[model samples]
Target: MAASALISPAIHAVRSASAIVCKEVIDSHVLRIDGYSRLKHMMHGKYIRSGDFHAGGHAWRLLYYPNGSQLQFQDHIAVYLQLASRDPNDEQVLARPRFSLLDQLGNPALPHDCGMHRFSY
Candidate 1:
């Protein structure tokens, strides 16, 4: 799993023209399961979550569902990205997340990509 964000300054109307600079921060975390077959035998809708990790100054985690998150998709697997940080001001965080299932040789077994997402309380 990989997460990235562009932390840009808030734009404002100025009487004088000026140049604004912005930077991007990228971070990633990988969760490897040694006994995936055993996990798949667990009850449906059950999930295992990764530990909290930081990306772009925010805490995040990943949820892995071996037997799928719901009964309708029990034959498949599911993964979700969750925001683990709470803001006192209830602000929203923007991030782009990408998930992939890697094979034993460290290659992508499936393609899972997502667009920009807004995360809040």
Candidate 2:
């Protein structure tokens, strides 16, 4: 939902007769909009990409998933925040913080919220 919140306007959620169809159109667009050309203009060196990890994170970029995608997204979003936090940038542009498997443990994982700390299970 956090990721969708950021992508909604830029990419409308298309609905179709079949879930497969909707996923085809909507999901592909997510990947395309995130392609190199778009990334060059939109993301630059900033943008952190974390997702619902209450169960250790799922690689659900709408529909696409790959190895380490979860961690990759986290690192990406963090980079953006790190840069924007120090410079004049739009904080609202942030990817609303969401839960991750990283935090679905004994204690809450406030990595960024608390200097992005790490803990062992």
Candidate 3:
């Protein structure tokens, strides 16, 4: 089966679960890593967090790992999306946003829909 065919259900599920309306399949914001070789060496064994970027009307950032954080994923790189800004009173602040890694050719390196959570806030 094609990648798009495989990911359609996941996207639909995220929309239904989070009530998140996306104008596009993936969000427009892209995080590019240029000098990864030197960066990882400089900040050894520590996570690199990006500056705040807007997504779903809230601030979000990419937490990157040059070296994996745990033993299980030590040989592989890991990245996480963190909710950078929040309001206790905001209902739509915490959302189940999908994350994906795109190759240099713009193909998704992994499955598109990686997260599906029901946020109480």
Candidate 4:
């Protein structure tokens, strides 16, 4: 089996001048799994991570699980966004991460997409 996914990051920034203002920066990356069936059998709870990608001045990666992260949900697949960059002060990084399964034609599989989750790291 083979699978593909799109991971999009939406970063929210707040700027304070005479008045406070907010902005958003959106970026995305595609992750392709060539041998998903083999991975599912070989890697259970463990995950395959994507190479470092950048968004909103921070480095990020996608954690793909062939099976679920936990035993109870083993029948399902899971994906997570991880912060790959390290800050000297260990400041938290905030982002809204969206995960979508791609169709055979490389478009998003509607209704099969995961909702955006607020992530802080």
| Highest-scoring model, TM-score | 1
- Residue 67, candidate 2: alpha-carbon lDDT: 23
- Name the weakest run of 10 consecutive residues (lDDT summed) in model 1: 22-31
Per-candidate RMSD vs. true structure?
17.5, 25.0, 19.3, 22.7
Selected candidate, larger lDDT, 2 vs 3: 3
- Model 3 steric clash pairs: none
Q: What TM-score against the true fold does each predicted structure earn? A: 0.75, 0.18, 0.62, 0.73
lDDT score, candidate 4: 0.80
Report the error of model 4 at residue 87, Å: 2.9
Candidate 2's residue-wise lDDT over 1-121, tens digit each? 3554445546679877845442211111111223634444454444435332221121222222222135555333222211112223332222333332243344534433323322211
What local lDDT score does residue 71 receive in model 1, on the 0 to 100 scale? 85
Which parts of model 4 have CA positions greater than 4 angstroms off?
1-17, 110-121
lDDT of 3 at 21: 72
Which tens-of-lDDT digit does each residue in 46-106 have in candidate 4?
9989999998788899898889899999988888889888866657766767677789998
Better of 2 and 4 by lDDT: 4
* lDDT (Cα, tens digit) per residue for candidate 3, span 9-114: 3444434344667553335567788897777666556788888897666677878888777767655667777777766767554355665678889876775565
Global CA lDDT computed for model 2: 0.31
